[model samples]
Target chain A: MEITPEKLRWIYTTMYRIRRFEEVLLEQTALGKSMGVAHTSDGEEAGPTGICAHLTDDDWIASTHRGHGHCIAKGVDTAGMMAEIFGKHTGLCKGKGGSMHIADFTKGMLGANGIVGAGIPLGVGAALSAKLKGDGSVGVSFFGDGATGEGTIHESMNLASVWKLPAIFVCENNHYAESTPVEYAVSVADIADRAASYSMPGVVVDGMDVFAVYDAAGEAIARARAGEGPTFLELKTYRYHGHFHADDPHTYRLPEEEELWKARDPLPNFERRVTEQDLMDDVEMERIRNEIDQEIQDAVKFAEESPLPPLEELYTDVYVNYSNPPQGLR
Target chain B: MTLDLRPDPLGPGFDVPGSEIRYREAFNRTLGDELRRDPDVFVMGEDVAGGAGREHLGIIDSWGGAFAATKGLIQEFGAERVRDTPISEAGFVGAAIGAALTGTRPVVDLMYFDFITVAWDQLLSNAAKNRYMFGGQGKIPITLFARSGVAAGYSAQHSQNFYSMVAHIPGLKCVAPSDAYTCRGLLAAAIRDDDPVIVCNHKKLINMSSFVPDESYTIELGKGRYLRRGSDVTLVGMSYTTEVCRLAAERLAEQGINAEVVDMLSLSPIDEDIVLESVTKTNRIVIVDEDTPRCNMASDIAALVADKAFDSLDAPVKRVTGPHTPVPYSKPLEDAFIPSPEDVVATTVALLGA
Candidate 1:
C-alpha cells in the first residue's frame, strides 16, 4: 500500500497527539492536579493510531483501561476527556466515569472498561446490531494480551463468527498483563492463532511499524464490512509506563527489558522510514509536533477551567425517573 | 383524581380479574400484539424459530423455544424480527441491551432463569445499572423472559427459583406473574418500561389458562393485587404461591376465618401501601413464598411489615416458605420441601390465634 501525503500526515499527527496527551497527564499527576489511577498508552500509540486511521467514525470501537490513545484516535474530544480525568462536569461521562470508564457514544467509542475483557462482548453486540440493521458499519474491540484469557472474549468470538457479524478483535500484545508477563500466563504461542478455532481469519503485525498496522487493519475492516464476519489481529507492542501511575516499578519488570523496548521506539522508527522515503521533511514533522503540543496544552487549560459536577448530581441519574425507585432508595 | 385507587378491571393496575389462558400462550399473544402494534419490538432467544438449518424436517418455527412460549412469533413476524440465537447467552443478552440502548426494544428468553447467572455481569453491571451508573444518560428498555420454579423432576440445578437474587440488585425490576392475564400485561409493561426488567415465569403456570382482554394492556410494576379479600388475615403470595393462597383461603373460610389473599406481583418496589393497608385491617399476616426461607421474599416482607407497621400488627408475622434445602428430585421430598396450602392455612390460623 502506497503512503499518501495526507494519510502519512494523519498517522503522524494522531500518534503525536496521543503521546503529548499522555505527557500532559503525567505532568498533571506530578503537580497533584489529578486523582485516581491512570495508565499511559505511551509505547502502544502506534497500534491504536494506525488501526483507527483505517476506520470511519461510524465504526464502533471498545477500549481497555489503558485507553486514552484509542479514545483520541477514535475522535473523542480531548477537552471532554481531560475534564473527565479532572472530575469536572464537562467530562465525557458527565464526571461519573473517570479515566477507566470514559465513553462517547456519539463518536462510536463504546467505553474503556475497568474490568479486564468486559468490552469484548459489547463490541460483538454492536456488530450484531449493525448486521441485523443491515448497515455496513464494523465494530472493533481493543484489549491487552491479558484479555485473551477471559471467557467473555472466547464466547464473543464464537458468537460473532457463528452469526457472521462485522467485527474486528484487536489484541495489543504489549508482552505484559499488568505485573505478569504474557509468556507466563497465556497457553497459546500467539493470540491470533486462537481465532482459527472460531473459523475467522487472524493476523499478527509489528505494532511499532504504523504502516504495517494500517495495512492489516484496512484489510480486516474491509472484510468485516463486506459481510465476511469477524477477524482477530494481534499487534505486537509494549508500554513504556508502569501498569498505573501508582504502581511500584521495582517489584516486577526488569529495568534492562524496559530499556530495550524504549530503544525501538515507534515514533523515531516511523520518522526515519517516512524521511528516508522522502514522504515528508523534518521541518513539516517538527511543525506537526508543535501543533499537537499546542492542542494538548489547550486541553489542559480547558480541564483546569471546567467546573466540577454539582453535589445534586449525586442523587440524579440513578434512574430514568424516581417514581418507582429501587427498594434500597426508599 | 386521588390516583384512581379503585382498580380498573381491564387496566394494568392491581385488583384486575385473572385470565384462564396458559402462561406460555399469554406470552406468545403479548409478543405478537406488541410486534404488530410497534414496528421496533422484536423477539430473540434460543430455538425461538424452532428450526433454522435443519433441511430434513422442513419445519419452520418448530421448537418455538424450549417451552414453546415463542412458538408462533417467527411465523407472524418473519426472520428479521423473530431471531433465534446460537445458545450464546451472554452474547445475545448483551446484544439485546445494546439494541435497546440504540433503538429497538427486544424481548430475550434465557430458556431457564438459572442460565441468567452466565449473563449476570451484563444484566447487573451493564443493563441494570446503566441508567444510574451513567448518571441517567441512557435507558435500557429491555425485557428478559425466563422460566423459574421447581418442575418436580428437573432436580436442583433446573428447579430452584432465583428471583431473590435479582430482587437483591438495585435498578432491576423483577416480576413473577401468577397467571395468564398478569403475564400478558406484565410482559407488555416490561417491554415498554425504560428500565431493565426480569420476568420470572413459573414452568408449572405455563399451561394454566385464564380470561384475557382482547385489547392490549400493561400491568404496572410495583403494584400488588388483592386476589381474594378477607377480614381474619392477609395471606400474601406471588407467582405459583398465588395458587397455594387461593386453596389456603378456601380452607380458612371453611373454619369461619376470612383470609384476604394479596398477590405481591411486583417484588422489588413492592406495593407497600396495599400490603400495609391489608395488614392494618386484618391485624394478622402470613407471607408465603416458594423460595427457601433465608433471605427470601418471606423474610423481606416480614422485615417490611416489622419496620413500617409493627404497632398495627396484632401478632408476630408468620412465614410459610420452602424448606432451607435445595429443591429435591423425589416427588414426596419435593412436595415436602415446597410450602403447601395446608401450611398456609395452618400458619395463618396460628398467627391469628396468637
Candidate 2:
C-alpha cells in the first residue's frame, strides 16, 4: 500500500506527540508534579502509532501499563490524559484511573490495565461485541511480551479465531516482562507464531518501523473488518527505560542492551526516513515537533493548575445507581 | 403463587408456576428473553455458541457450554449477540465488565466456577467493586454464571465452591439457587440488578427439571425460604445442599423429629430473619454445605446464629459440611468428601438426641 502524505504526517505527529508527552511526564515526575508510578512509552512509539493508524475512533484498543503511546495513537485527549496522570478532576477517567488506568471510552480507548495480559480478553470481548453488533469495528489488544505468557492471551486468541470475532492481538514484544527478559518467561520463540496454533494469521513486524507496523496492522484490521476473525501481530521492539519510572537502579538489564535499544529509537528513525524520502520537509517536521512540544507543555500546565479530585469524589462513580450509599460513603 | 409479604424462612414469595426450569435452560431462556427485551443485553463466553466452526453442523450449540445451557442461542440471536469467546477468562470477563460499564449488560459464562481464578481480579476488583469504588458513578450490571460444586466426577480444580469468597466481598452479591424455580427467578433478578452478581449453578442441577412459569418472574436477593417447616429442628442449606437438607428432613421425620428446611438462596445479604425465626422456633439447628468446612457458608451462618439467636438454640449448631480436603476423583472418596443427606440426618439426629 502506498503511504499518503496526510497519513505520513499523522504518523509523525502522533509519534512526536507521544515522545514529547512522555519526556514532559518524566520531567514532571522528577519535579514531583505527578503522583503514581509512571511508565513511559518513549521507545515503543512505532508499535502503537503504526497499529493505531489503521483504527478509527470507534475501533477499541486496550493498552498496557506503558500506554501513553497507545493513548495518543488512539486519539485520546492529551490534556485530559495528562490531567489524569496528575490525578486532577479534568483527567480522562475523572482522576479515577491514574497512569496505569487511563481510559477514554468515548474514543474506544479502553483503560490502560495494570495487570499484564489482562487487556487481551477485554479486546477480544470488544471484538466480540463489534462482531455481534455488526459494527464493522475491530478491537485491538496491545500487551508486552510478558503478557504472552498469560493464559488469557492464548485463550482469547483461540476464542477470537473460533468465533471469527473482529479483533487484533498486538504483542508489543518489548524484550522484558518487567525485569525478566522475554526469553526467560515466554516458551515460544515467536509470540506471533502462537497465533497459528489458534488457526489465525500471525505476523511479526518491525516494532521500530512505524510504516511496517501500519502495513501489517492495516491488513489484519481489514481482515477483521471483513469478518475474518482475529490476527496476532508481534511487534518486535524494546523499551529504553526500566519497567516503570520508579524502576531505578536498573540492575536487571545490561547497560549495553539499553544503549542498543536507545540507538534504534523509533522517533529519530521515522524522522530520518521521512526526511530522506522527502515525504516531510525538515522545517515542517521541526514545526510539528515544536507544536507537539507546546501542546505537551500546555497539558503539563493544565494538569499542574487543575485541582485534585475532591475527597467526596472518592465516593462517586462506584455504582451507576446504587440505592444506598456505599459503606464508606455512608 | 402470590408474592408472600411474610418473608418466609426460604424467602418472601411462593414458587412461581414455571420457576422449575433446569438451571442451564433457565440461563439460556433468560439470555434470550433479556436480549429480546433489551437490545443492549448480550451473551459472551467460551463455546457459548457450541458449533462455531464445524464443517457440517449436525447438532446445535455442540458446546452449549459444557452442560448445554446456552445451546441454540446463536441460531436465535446470531453469532454477534451469542458470542463465543476464546479461553481468555480475564480478557472476556474484564471486557464484559467494561462493556457493562459502557451501556451494555453482558452475561459472561466462566464455564466452571473454579476457572474464575484466572479472572478473579476483574470479577472481584473491577466488576464487583467498580460500582462501589466509583462511588455510584458507574453500575456494572454484569451477571457471571458458573457451574460450581463437586459432581459428575469432576474433581479438585473444577469442583470447589467459591461463592463464599465472593460473598466475603462487600460490593458483590452471591446467589446459589437450590432448584430450577429459584434459578430462573434469581437469574432474572440478577440481570436487572445494578450490582455485579455471581450465580453459582450447581453442575448436578443442570438437568434437574422443575415447573417454570410461562411469564417472566424475579426472585429478590438476600432472601431465604422454608422448603419444609417443622417445630423440632431447623436445617439450613444452600445450592445443592438444599436438596440434601430436604432429604435429611424427610429422614428425620421418620424418627418423629419435625425438621424445618431452610434454603438460604442468597448468600451475601443473608436472610437473617428467616434463619433467626427458624432457630427461635425449633431451638435446634443444623447447617449443611457442599463447600469445604473452613470459611464457608456453613461457618458464616453458624456464626450468625450464634451471635443473634444464641438464647433460642436448644443445642450447639451442627455444621454438616464437605471435608476440608480437595474434592477427590474417586466416587467413594468424593461422596465421602461432600456432605450427604445421611450426614445431614445424622448431624440433626445427634443434635436433637433422637
Candidate 3:
C-alpha cells in the first residue's frame, strides 16, 4: 500500500496527539485536578495510530485499559475524553466511566475495558454484526501481550475463525502487564504464534515504526473485509510510564531496559523517518507538533472547566426504563 | 383447577392441544417464532446448534443445549442464525452483549445457572453496566437464558437458584416463570425489552405443561399475577416454589383454611403493590423460595413486608426456603434440600396458630 502525503501527515499528527494527551493527563493528575488513576500509552503510539488509520466510523475498535491512544486514533473527541477523566457531567460517559472506561460509540470506538482480554469477544460480536448486516465493516480488538494469556482471547479468536467473521486481533505487546513481565506470564515466545492454533495468520510488526504497522494492518484489515476471517497482528510495543499513575516500575523492571526502549521512541523515530524520506519537512512537523500540543491543552482546559455530575444522576442511567425502583435500592 | 385466562389455545389445530406442550417446547416455539418474526434475532450457545461441521459423522445438533430448550432451533433458523459456540461462556456472552449494543437482539444460553461464575464479569461488569457506564448511549437488548432449581439429582454444582445474585445488580432484570405459560410470555417479553433480562427456567418445571397460547404474547415484567385468591392468608411463591405453594394452598383448602397463592414471577422489580395489597387483606404472609435461606428473595420479600406492611400483619411473617446447604445429588437428599409443599403448608398453619 502506497502512503499518500495526507495519510502520512495524519499518521504523524495522531501519534503526536496521543503522546501530548497523556502528558497533559499526567500533569492534571499531578496538580490534583483529576482524582482517578490512568494508564498511559506513552511509548506505544504507532500501533493504534497506524491500525486505526485503515478504519472508518462504520468499522469498530475495542480497546484496553491503556486506551487513550486508540480512542484518539479512532477519532474519539479529545475534549469529551478529558472531561470523562475529570468525572464531569459533559464527559463521554456523562461522568460515569472515568479514564479507564472512555468511549465514543459515535466513532465506533468501544469503551476502554478494565478487565484484561475482555474486548476481544466484544470485537468478535461486532464482527458478527457486520457480517450479518453485510456492511463490509471489520472490527478490531486492541489488547496487550499480557492479555494473550487470558482464555477469552483464545476463545474469541477461535470463534472468529470458526465463524469466518470480519475481525482483526491487534496485540499491543507492551512487554509487561502491571509488574509482571510477559517473559514470565506468557507461555509462547511470540504472542502471534499462538494464533496458529486457531488457524489464522499471525504476523509480527515493528510497533515503533508507523509505516510497518500501517502496511501490516492494511493487509489484515483488507483480508477481514473480504470475509477471509481474522488475523492476529502482534505489535511489539512498550510503555514508558508505570502501569497506573501510582505504580513504580523501578521496583520490577530494570532502568537500563527502559532507557533502551526510550531510545526507539515512536514519535521521534517517525519524525526522522518521514523527514528523511521527504514525506514531510521539519517545518511542517514542528507545526503539527505545536498544533497537537495546543489541542491537548484545550482538552485539559475543557475538563477543568466542566462541572461534576449531580448526585441525582446516579439512578438515571442504570436501566433504560427503570420505573419501579426495586424496594431494596429505593 | 388451573387458571385458563385466555381462549382455549387449540380448537382448530390439527394434532394436539396447545396445553399439551412442555415448557421446553414453549421456549423452542418462542425462539422459532421470533426468528421468523424478526430478522435481527438469533440464538447462540454451547451445543445450541449441536453438531457443527460434523455432518458426515451424522452428529447434527446432538445435545440441543444442556436442557433441550434450543432443540431443533437450528433446523428452523439455519446455522447462521442458530449458532453453536465452544465451551466459552465469557467470550460468547460478551459477544452477545456487543451484538445487542450494535443491532442484533441475541438470546444467549448459559446452559446452567451454576456456570455463571465463569462468565460473571462479562454479564455483571459489561452487559449490566454497558448502557449506564456509557451514559445510556446504547441498548443491550440481550436475553441470558439459564436453568435453575433443585431436583433432578444434578448435584450441588449444577443445581442452585442463583438468579438472586444477578437480580441484586442495578441494571439487570430477572424473570422466573412458574409454568409453560409464564415461561413463554415472560421469555418473549425479556427478549423484546431494551435492557438485559435473565430468564431463569426451573429445570424441574421445564417438563411441566400449561394452557399456552399458540401465538406469542408478553407478560409485563414487574406485575405479579395471582394464581388463586382467598381471605385467610397470602402465600408468596417464586418460580418453581409457586407449584409447591399452590399444592399447599389446595391442602389448606381441604382443611377449611382459605389460602391465597401469588406467584412472584418477576423477582427484581417485584410487584410490591400486589404484595402489599394482599398483605393488607390477609394480614398474614408466607414467602417461599428455592434459594438458600439467607440473602435471597425470601428475605427481601420478608423485609419489604416488615418495613412497609408491619401495621397490617396479624402475626410475624414466615419464610419457607431450601436449607442453607448445597443441593445434594441423592434423590432423598435433594428432596429434603428443596422446600416441599408440606413445608409451606406447615409454615402457614404454624403462623396462623401463633
Candidate 4:
C-alpha cells in the first residue's frame, strides 16, 4: 500500500489522539471527575486507526468495552465523549451512556457495548441493512479475543457469510478477558482461523504495526466493498492497562509480557517509520503532540464546566409515548 | 388514574363488521398490510418465509412459520421483504435490533414465547435499553411476535406464557390481544409504535374467529376494553385469559352474578386506570392470568389493587392463576396446570359472597 503524506499524518494523529484520550481520561477519573468504570484502549490503537482510516461516516462500526480508540478513529467528538464519561448534560449521550457505551450514530459509531459479544450481530445487522438499501456501506465489529468464545460471534459470522453481507469482524487479541488468559479460553490457536468454519477469508495481522494492519485491512475491506463477503482479521494486540480502570494488570500479566508488548507501542513505531522515511520531521511530530495535549486539557475543562442532566431525565426516552399512569415523579 | 378508555377501541367502524377471521389470519394480514404500508418494514425469523433462497428448487415459503401466522406472505412480498433466517435466535434477534437501531422497521417472529430466553439478553440489554441508554437519540421500532402458552403437549421447553418477565422491564412494551379483532389492531399498533414492542400471540386463540374490519387503524396502546359489562363484580384477564374471563362471565350470569369482563390488552403500559376503575366500581375483582401464580401478571395487578384501591374493595383481590410449576407434558397434568374458567368463576363467586 502506498503511503500518502496526508494518510500518514492522519494515522499518527488518530492513534496519538486515542493514546492521549485514554491517558487523560484516567487522570480525570482519578481526580473524581468521571462517573463509572472506563476500559482503556491504550495499546490497541493501530487496529481501529488503521482500519477506520479506510472508512467514512457512511460505514458503521460496533465497538466493545475497550472502545475509546474506535470512537476517536471513527471521528466521534472527543470533547463530547469526555463530558459523557463525566456524566454531564453536554455529554455525547446526554450524560447517560458514560464510558462503556459512548455512541454517535451520525458518525457510524454504533456504540461501545457493555456486554461481551452483544455488539457483533449489530454490525451484521448494519451490513444487512446496507445490502437491502444498496447503499454500498459496510459494518465492522471490534471485540476482544475473549469474545470469540461467545456464541454471538460465531452466529454473526455465519449469518454474514451466508447472506454474503459486507461486514468485518476484527478481534483484538489483547491476551486477557478480565483475569482469564486468551490461550486458556479460546479453542483455536488463531482466532482468525475460526472464520474458515464460516467460509470467510481469515487473516492474521500484527496489531502493533499500523502499516501492516492498514495493508491487510485494505484488502479485506476491498473484498467486502466488492460484495464478495465478510472477512475476519485477528490483530494480535495488547492493552497496557487492566480490563477496567480499577483493575491491576500486574495481578494477571507478567512484568516481561507487559514490557515486551509495550516495546512495540504503535505511536513510537509510527514516529520512527515516518521520520526515517523522511515523510515527516521531528518539529511536525512535536506540533501534533502539543496540539493533542492541549486538546485533552480543553476536553477536561469542558466536562468540568458542563452541568449534570436535569432530574426529570429519569422519565424520558423509555418509549415514544406511554400514557398510562403518565411519566414523571410522584 | 381512571378507566378513561377513549371511546371504544373497536371504534364506530364496528357499525359495519367487515368479515369473520381467525387470529392467525388477522396476524398474517396485518403483517402483509404493515409491510406494504411502509417500505422500510421487513420481517426475519426462523422459517418466517420458509425455504426461501430455494427458488431454484421451487420451494418458497414451504412452512410459512410454525403456526402458519405468516402463511402465504412470501408469495406476495417476495423473499427479500419477508426473509427467513438460520435457527440462531439470539443472533437474528440482535441483528433485528441492530437494523432497527440504524434505520428500518424490523418485525421478528420469535417462533415460541419459551424461546424468548435464548434472545432475552439482546432484548433486555440492547433492544429494550438502547433508546434510553443512548440518551434518547434513537428509536428501536422493532416488533417481535410469538405464540405464547402451553398447549397441545408442547411440554415445558416449547410452551410458556412469560410476558410477565418482559413486562418487568421498563423499556420493552408487551401486548396480549384476546380476540381476532384486537389481535389485528394491536399488532398494527405495535408495528407502528416507535419502540421495542412484543406482540404476545396466545396458542389457544390462534384458531378462534371474530369480526375484523378491513381498514387499517391502530388501537391506543396500553389501553384495555370491556367485553362484558355488569355491576356485581369485575373479572379481569389478558390474551386467552380474557376469553376465559368472557366464559366465566357467562357462567356467573347463569347464577345471576352480574360479572363485568375487562380484557387487559397491553400488559407493559397496562391500563392501570382500567384495572383500578373496574375494581372501584365493582368493589370486588378476580384477576385471571394463565402465567404462574408467583410474581406474575396476576400478582402485579393484585398488588396494584391492594395499594391503590384498598378502601374500595368489598373483599381481598382474588387471583385465579396457574400453579407455580413447569407446564407439564402429561395431558391431565397440563390441563390441571392451566388456570381454567371454572377457577375464575369460583374465585369471583367466592370473593363476591365474602
Which is the leading candidate under TM-score?
4
- Who wins the DockQ comparison? 4
The candidate with the higher TM-score, 1 or 3, is: 3
Sort all candidates by lDDT, best to worst.
4, 3, 1, 2
Give DockQ per model, in order. 0.53, 0.27, 0.69, 0.78
Least accurate stretch of 10 residues (summed lDDT) in model 3 chain A?
A321-330
lDDT of 3 by residue, A1-330 (tens): 798898999999999989998888888888987769899998899999999999999998888989999999999989999999989999999989888888888999888998888877888899999988899999899999888888889889988999999999999999998989999998888889988999999999999888899999999999999989999999998998899977879999999999998999998898888778888999999999999888889888898899999887787678876548533456
Can you give the lDDT of residue B2 in candidate 3? Answer: 27
What CA root-mean-square deviation does each model show from the true structure? Answer: 2.8, 4.1, 3.0, 2.0
**Residue ranges of candidate 1 with Cα displaced over 4 Å:** A2-4, A326-330, B1-20, B55-57
lDDT of 1 by residue, A1-330 (tens): 766799899999988889889888988977876757788898888999888998887788878899999999998888888888888888887777778878887788877878787778778877877876777888898999998888878888888888888989999999989989999999988889999999999999898788899999989998999998899999999888788876765588888988888777889989999999899889999999998888888888999999989977776665554355444446
- B1-354: candidate 4 lDDT, tens digit per residue: 112234454555576547999999989999999999998999989998888999999888888998887789899888878889998989999888888887889999999998899999999999988777788877889999999987899989887899789998988999999988888889998999898999999899999999887776677788888878888998998999998888989998999999988899999888888888888999999989999888999998898989899999978888898888899999999999888889888888778777
Provide backbone clash counts, one per model. Answer: 11, 38, 2, 0
How well does each candidate superpose onto the true structure, as a TM-score? 0.94, 0.85, 0.96, 0.98
lDDT of model 4 at position B254: 96
All candidates' lDDT scores?
A: 0.83, 0.81, 0.87, 0.89
* CAPRI quality of model 2: acceptable
- Choose 1 or 4, whichever is better by TM-score: 4
